[model samples]
Target: MTKELLTGNTAVALGARLSGVEYVPAYPITPQTEIIERLSRWANEGAMDARVVTMESEHSMLTAAGAASVAGVRTFTATSSQGLLYGFEMLYNIAGWRAPLVLANVSRGVASPITLEPDHNDVLSARDSGFLQIHAETCQEALDSVIMAYRIAEDDKVRLPAMVNLDGFYLSYTREPVDVPEQERVAEFLPPYRPQSGYMSAKNPMSVAVVVLDGRAYSYFKYQMHLASTNALAVHEKVAGEFEKAFGRKYPAVEGYMLEDADYAIVITNSLTTTARAAVQEMRKEGKKAGLVRIRLVRPFPRQQVADMLAGKKGVAVFDQNISVGSGGILYPEILSALYHRSDRPKKVVSFIGGLGGKRVGHTEFRHMVAVTEGCVRDDSQLASVLLFTDSDWQAVKGMLRTAGKGEVSQ
Candidate 1:
């Protein structure tokens, strides 16, 4: 066991090195470039036995990763925001072919009018692309999840690509103390890659990721993908348990902090949970019962665990860094769907959209989010609204709403 202060990118690099990744397809993108740089330095120094391929673009980068993994090498890659989108086709192709490649997605905001900041939109957009998605809340998890992603991706029952995402600027550059296990221990936990079925050879040639038959075949393929994702929930827990046996830490799909006896709670993901934790602590000190649920695994949705955690609470607030256009927030609908069928549910479930485009979400802003939820619990008529925007923006929003009223058109 070795403890070192490292930025999230370095931790991921160290984790990949420890996991004995044999190949890395490198492409530079903001927030994720440091990871490739560190891995290249390690490879150059002979610290890791890996081939680093500098590709011209993300599309080529992922294609190389998929090809390398299919060639029976444990492969890894990193990308962000538009980079992921640019290589979207390769992502689906990798999963469709059941190729196990580990992807470290340093979460960055998507572009219309672009800004490089931490947001979930980029990763969330790929939620349906048949890859296992895990969101990291800390530098340690960012490191640990990479190792787990490899294990999960290679499992015979869930043979698919895996993506481990960390918030862009907040986590990628933030320095924190991380425990990087010895290479021997990591090897013991995650053994060297052994592909279940060897790659395409002249003796056993096969077409990988070819287009399938009709709608029935397509539906069957999708159904099998769903089953794989569903099976991943249990695989994740088992892998986390195994990781705990090797390292002294355990992580769950959904982690609840002080939720057992709390009257209200906030659900969050990524680095924002750290800020929300402080707010929850203050609320606890004031004798106002508030707890927090941080989702480590976003895809496969952890519906059961989340429903159980929020059951019987007075109020629940979900904070999303990404919006779904006219909808409240992306995670908001999922959380609501999770709790909808439950007989006993939180009194008021509110959605608060904040921290878009890497905007700072301070303790004050978190407190305001909590206050809004509290008000909704008290008077059930507060009406759903997005928090942490300027008052002038609300005026503009109101004008748009009025002009676009129920089938109304603007000239």
Candidate 2:
């Protein structure tokens, strides 16, 4: 193993190459394109042995990779917000077919007004689509998660597609020192893909993409897919354990820092967790028992494990990069449901939203969010679920509107 400075996307590309992937069908999409671009360049330079095919659209890209996967070889692909949605139908179909393909989805918010930035909505919107998900907080995790993704996806009990998520500009573009494992060591960790049945071969011509006759049959098959996805929870833990032994790094389903006896904490994911951790340290300096629970595996939900982590805290704030339109923070509500029936559930929990559309969420935002959570605990009050706008956020918008009106009247 050797330490090298690499961007998240570059790390991901190397992760796939090192995983012994034989096929990659993909299209270029912002924040996600670099991954495919790197692989494409490597294959062209004769450094990587893989088939990198460029398709017309994300939909075709997913279709090609999905077909290649069930044909009995390892495959990979990637996309961001709009590209992910564009290939949405094929995602469900591939999962149902139980193809063990690995995909990297660099998170980005969906567009209406249109902006390029990172958010969980692009990923969370597909939470129930029968794919295992790992949200990485650092460039190292981004690389390791992609490697682990292949192991988990190809597991017999969890023969499904897997998605490894990283924040768009945040982790995607940021450089960090990552431990690049040797290909020999990675080979020892990840086994070759060999499915039970339905492989593409002239000697064994098996029917592919057969039609299901009735709703009852479809429901039963879908339930089977659900069971396979849930099986990933245990599979992930096992893979993560072996990964550490192989690479000398540890990655759990949920990473809890200073949560053992904390009275308050923050539940967050991806790159922002770094800032939250620093914020917790500052709070600690001030004699506050603040901590952080960083989510690693989001799908399969890890509900029981997460509940165990947050149950005894006096209060906790949820940091979400994605909004659920009329509802609230997508992760916050799900977390509430997880802890609701627990005897030791926290008395107060609040949601704080920021970092959408590539907005910077730094120390100032972290301080504000932590303050709100602590105040909620002290007052024993329930706060509204969304924190979309602060007094200052609104004031700035109002100031812009005033300037626009003045210019219109002067004209």
Candidate 3:
């Protein structure tokens, strides 16, 4: 193995190159464009034997990927917030075709009040698109997840497309040291894509469209996708084990830090997980008994795994970088629902939303989040009150405005 300092985008491109992805049809978008740019450069230099095409739109890019996959070729592509939404229609179609491929999603908040930063909403928006999803916390995880994405997606029981999501600016552009695994080991981990040698061929006389006018037929196909997705959870774990054996790295569905004996905990995902980890360390230093759990496999949601980790805890704070407007944090409700029916579930699960549009979630916010969760545990409050309670802590900004006011209201 060779260690090199690589940005998250470059790591993703390297992963795809190692996987020997033969087709990549991409469109440029902020943050994610670097991945395409790198791959295009490699293709041009003949360092990577791949066809990197710059398409007119993300939709066209996805369409090209689907077309290639249908013809039994390995395919890959990437996009960000707006670009992902632009190709929304094709996202559904590609998965329905059972065209197994990988799409790297550099997560960005959706538009309306547009910002060129990171959020989970863009990729989570495709939750029902029959795509397996794995989110990464570091540059290394970003590269490693890409490799696992292909392996899991190509499993016979889970033959569907997949998405590897990394926060746009946080993980994508940031540089870090990553162990570049030998190509021979990667080949052993992920063999050549030889599925449907005689079936998915263009030479085969078969129709692509499924004419389903009845609800039952549509449900049948959709349910099949669901089954495949549910099966992917197990498939992902198996692949992760093999990955660890091959590269000495572990990517659990949910990674726990100091949760075993903690009274309160925090649950998070993506790059913010590093911040949460730091917070947990500080909490430990102060003897507060706080902990964190980072969600890696999001699509299958890892319900059982999450429940097992959070069951014995007294209180838990869920920090989601994406807000669902009227609904609050997107991941907050999912965590609640997963543990709600469990007998050993945490007494309180508080929701805290921060870090939208690539906003920085600093040390103060982390401390505040833990404080709120601890308070909920102390007071025996419900989820509604916890939301109101956290929301009430607006003094951070109010105090700043108060200073600018200079002891007077704004004129």
lDDT of each: 0.89, 0.88, 0.88
Query: What order do candidates take by lDDT, descending?
Result: 1, 2, 3
> In candidate 1, how many Å is residue 397 off?
15
Clashes found in each candidate (C-alpha, N, C closer than 3 A): 0, 0, 0
Clashing pairs in 2: none
Per residue, candidate 2 scores C-alpha lDDT tens digits across 10-68 of: 99998999999899998998888899999999999989899899999999999988888
- TM-score of each candidate? 0.93, 0.95, 0.93
Lowest summed lDDT across 10 adjacent residues in model 3 is found at 384-393
Reference-based lDDT, residue 246, model 2? 79
Model 3 Cα shift for residue 355 (angstroms): 0.2
Identify the superior model by lDDT, candidate 1 or candidate 2. 1
RMSD of each: 4.6, 2.4, 3.4
Point out where model 1 deviates above 4 Å: 392-411
Q: For model 2, what is the alpha-carbon lDDT of residue 112?
A: 83
Specify the highest-lDDT model's number.
Answer: 1
